[model samples]
Target: MNESSDLQRFQELIEASAERELTEVETAFIGRMGFRSEQCRQWLEADAEVVAAAVEQDPLRTVPAATTLDWARVDAGLRRAGALPDSRAQSRNAWPLLPAAAALLLCIGVINAILRDGLSTTPQAPPEVVAEVLDLPEGDGSLILHEGDDEGVLMIILSNG
Candidate 1:
């Protein structure tokens, strides 16, 4: 039969198989069409060694097929073969860089602290401002005081009774 007819037959077999435990007629029909035993194996009791061989040969084999196998070993093998990147080396390499980076940062911080402390603690030379005396307007009792910083008091006399 053509591919289209084969596909149609395959779909009908799957729908019939889903309704109940596979009947002999369905199994015969499936086997005649050269279908894989993987789905049909569910209808029969599987040998442990046979199932394990399948899992060992192909890690992606069905999980129930793998139930009889040593999973940890298979899992490790699959991870090694799979695309998952190995991060152990990267993590190990990064750990060493952390202390080095921390040491660099500590050195920079210590240098900055020393510079800041030195700049702040050292006294600055006293300032000098030019001062000139000026007269107040008549009848306005005002006093302007220059207390070393060119800034001081400016106030009017209070006429307290």
Candidate 2:
């Protein structure tokens, strides 16, 4: 059985059109469902028969009323058989925040661009270059460390400039 085509036709009939005017695809589906196309076509081809027989027919005179069938097993069995694995794939949609995100990023970019010029133009004072040129509390001349016994040393040469 062409499960995909049959399912697609049923879906299209439910979504695209009503049951009154069945397309070729929908006819094929009803055929698979055990409905005779020739019987329905003969009934439809009879104009006076439709108006007088189907429409004007007394409800009490009919032997039995229309009946609805329960087909729960079809869907459950098809799912077990993996008839339409990709059916759920069509329903998923990506997040819709891209345009808003782009706008927010553009605002941030504009703000950053505007502030960059101001920050770059701001005056920055040069380093003193002579901090702690005097001696320490214990007569230390500079920020230097002297070690012994194979220890490390940190030397800071002071400049008057």
Candidate 3:
């Protein structure tokens, strides 16, 4: 058979083997394919058990029913027990501190900006140059360099200025 048909037949054989025993043709094919018959059969049986267990223990089927809530009654009980604060009074009491906290933050920011600006604006000293001069030999003579040429030496004259 063609390769694809062989694969399909192989799959069918495996599925049938998991359900029951292999047919004569399947047994021959498995032997030809070099499968260890006992181990292969055991693997197929284990796979079938895993699939069956997975189907039997589906997550959606095992989920508990959700508990219901009564939010209105809970809120009423908390209010009667005075456990919840009055929102308006809390907000009113908190307002007076806001401007003080904002002013302190603003002061800190201004101080940081001033310090950064001052550091960047500080004057730096200019670098000084010191030259080292070497004394030349006492002579009224000129220096000559002989470059590779048929011509004679090139003369360099020295001046005190």
Per-residue lDDT for 81-120 in model 2, tens only? 8884543443222222443344345445544544454223
> Each model's C-alpha lDDT?
0.48, 0.43, 0.50
Q: Candidate 1 has what TM-score?
A: 0.23
TM-score leaderboard ranking: 1, 3, 2
lDDT of 1: 0.48
Best by TM-score: 1
Query: Residue 62 in model 1: shift from native, Å?
Result: 13
What's the alpha carbon RMSD for model 3? 32.5
How close to the true structure is residue 86 of candidate 1, measured as C-alpha lDDT? Answer: 53
Which residue runs does candidate 3 get wrong by more than 4 Å?
Answer: 34-161
Report the lDDT tens digits of candidate 3 across residue range 117-158. Answer: 432344533212111122334321222212222233222222
Worst 10 residues of 3 by lDDT: 140-149
Cα displacement (angstroms), candidate 2, residue 84, comes to 18
Which ten-residue region of model 1 has the weakest summed lDDT?
A: 152-161
